[model samples]
Target chain A: MKMKCTISYDGHLFNGYQVQPGKRTVQAELEKALAILHKSEDKVPVISSGRTDSGVHAAGQVIHFDTPLSIPAERWPYALNALLPGDIAVKTAEHADDGFHARFSAIKKEYRYFVYTEKHPDVFKRHYAYHFSYRLNVQKMREASEHLIGTHDFTSFCSANTEVRDKVRTIYELDWTDTDDGLQMRIVGSGFLYNMVRIIAGTLLDVGTGKFSADDVKGMLDAKDREAAGRTAPGHGLYLWHVYYDN
Target chain B: MKMKCTISYDGHLFNGYQVQPGKRTVQAELEKALAILHKSEDKVPVISSGRTDSGVHAAGQVIHFDTPLSIPAERWPYALNALLPGDIAVKTAEHADDGFHARFSAIKKEYRYFVYTEKHPDVFKRHYAYHFSYRLNVQKMREASEHLIGTHDFTSFCSANTEVRDKVRTIYELDWTDTDDGLQMRIVGSGFLYNMVRIIAGTLLDVGTGKFSADDVKGMLDAKDREAAGRTAPGHGLYLWHVYYDN
Candidate 1:
């Protein structure tokens, strides 16, 4: 039977979401646990909605796999949690249709980024937020984000190493809000290229610092060059918040 | 010159607050940083408001030390923070009277505890909160807490290994509130014995679970026996929130 599961992870514990030679990863850990449960020598493959970079957390990452066990829906989380590490947890699990694919079937994705604007570092939240310490003009950042809210060629906002030839993507929503400590940004889009969110976040931060303007952002999009964008933000401050799909 | 400083730490990185031979402790780290700054072979002692056990965090732990270098008050924090580890930070620094002492000058202390009530563990907050899935009666816990307030012999709530002979202390206030992720507790008192706050939190949790009644808590205080109370809660969930003094 086909099984679907949603999981959350601290992200600091793994090298990244993909399997690598000798390095520990989220996929390797999940596959090991599943293989151990199956009592098989062959590796069990697990498909995820997408790959998150090193130190990039996930609140609602979905996956799908095949399992022969007849465990109830309520007991599925418990069964896997017993074997999983403390920094990872299976939030929910259920039987899924045989036709569904975790990555290809997803309609939209939401990501959140955190920036700490304090002059001094915070001991508790240091791991979760990037300490920028710059005087940011949030209003200017909001203006810059508005220019990139619709479908556009995001080549300037993606990593140069990306293999995806099509650079056009639709951004449904882009917003920034003040938190107790700093600023939080939530962006929803149909699909994202490699390092797309982080590059856009960095560009917005540059706009906040008056290094760029709203019109400059539109120019960068028009430039369609990766060098036109600012540096990529660190992965620790990013979170894959959720994924949307049509049933 | 006597220097008074306010600092915060992520306690999981240390063995405990006090300096111990061959153990990484908060006091040892502070003295090491100070001695390095002074470029002296002798250790510089740091007297804290009080000692916290291993894995217990601090938000506003005050300390006092004598320094020969006449650095300005505003620059003291930067100088010390540059030498301190990432898990610790100096929040503030100031010149202090020669007679002032961090331990004896402190008149009151506040503590906060966190309990995650969800049955499933939270991956992000695993290091900072205790997970207890049992159904809790918050009203009963509140009633039990009221009976514990005011001046009383806290022998039953203190650790059996405590060296302090006098266990009499006054609790000024106690409160519990719901947070987005879990339950939070705030407690203020004249002083606290070793493990006093954690033990009381554990006892209150027992009351929430119907293992003991509010009247039974009163009886436990009357008994004045260490074995009369519930087990001590883990140190990771407790934080030394603040210390108050008459300047």
Candidate 2:
């Protein structure tokens, strides 16, 4: 049977979402837990919507795995949570269609980046937000993000090491909002390139700090050069907020 | 010159607030940072409003120390923050009058306890909140908290090892509010006995869960026995929210 599960994790503890040899990764942990449930000596492979870098959190990461056990769909989360570490939890579980794939079938993804603008970092929220001690112009950042919406070539915003040749992607939504602690940037898109969201956040921060204007952001998009964009934001401040699938 | 400072700390990394012989503690860390600023051979002693237990946090803890150096009051926070670990930060600093003392002059203290009632704990807030899977009756908890307000002998709520001769304390406020993620209990008091707040939180949780009633809470207070109250709630969920002084 095919099982679909939605999980949330404190990514600070894991190396990343991918299974890396000798490193503690989320995928490795999930596969191990599933293997334990099945009493299998061999490692079980689970597919996730996408991989998140180290120290990046996820509120609603979707994954799917094949299981031989006959446990009810709803009970899978409970069983997995009992075995999972304190930082990782399965939020929901259900049986998926035979053709369903966590990654290939996903239609959209949403990501959020948090920035703490206080002089002194918030002790409690330090782990979840990047403490950027500079004053930000929210109006300028909003205006800059407006230029980033819709379909465009994001090569300037992607990591230089990415092997994927396609730089074109559709950004469904791009906006920023003020939160109690600081500013939060919300971006929904058809897909993202390697380090794309963080780079976008960094670029917008530059705009907020008066280093760049809204027009400069558009110029960077046209340049399609990684050097034209701002530095990539730290991974700790980014969250894989949600993944959407066309059912 | 005497300096008064307001600080906040993520207490998960410290053994506790006090300076234990070989343990990593908040006081020790602060003194170390101070010594670095003074470039002295001896550790500088710091006086805090009160001590917090291991795994507890503080949003606004007051402290004072005498320094031979004459750094401006406003610059002290920036200096100390440069040396202190990421978990601890000096929020503000100012010169104190000769009569001012962090502990002796404190007039009020406020504490907050967070309880995550979700079946699966929130990954992001796991460090700041206690995961309580049981359903709670908010009204019952509120009703029980009312009996706890006003001046009372808090012997039943104190730890067994507490050596303080006076068990009487004035609780100015005791209230609970439902939050988006969970329930938060806010308590303001003139002074708190050792483990008093945790015991109160645990006892109220018991009342909310139907293990005890509002009247039962009153009986336990009158009993004045340590075992009469519910178990002490874990330290991680407790936050020393604020410390107030007449100045």
Q: Estimate, for each residue in A57-131, the C-alpha lDDT of model 1 and write its tens digit.
A: 998999899888898877888888888888888999988899988898899999999999976678887778788
True contacts kept of each: 0.65, 0.70
**lDDT for model 2:** 0.93
The candidates' DockQ values read 0.75, 0.76
Show the lowest summed lDDT stretch of 10 residues, model 2 chain B.
Answer: B119-128
Q: Once superposed on the true structure, which residue ranges of model 2 sit more than 4 Å away at CA? A: none
Question: Evaluated with TM-score, which candidate comes out highest?
Answer: 2
Shift of residue B187 alpha carbon in model 1, Å: 0.8
How much does candidate 2 score in TM-score? Answer: 0.99
Q: Highest DockQ among the candidates is held by which one? A: 2
Per-residue CA lDDT of candidate 2, range A8-45, in tens?
99999899999999999999999989889889999878
Q: What share of the true interface contacts does candidate 2 keep?
A: 0.70
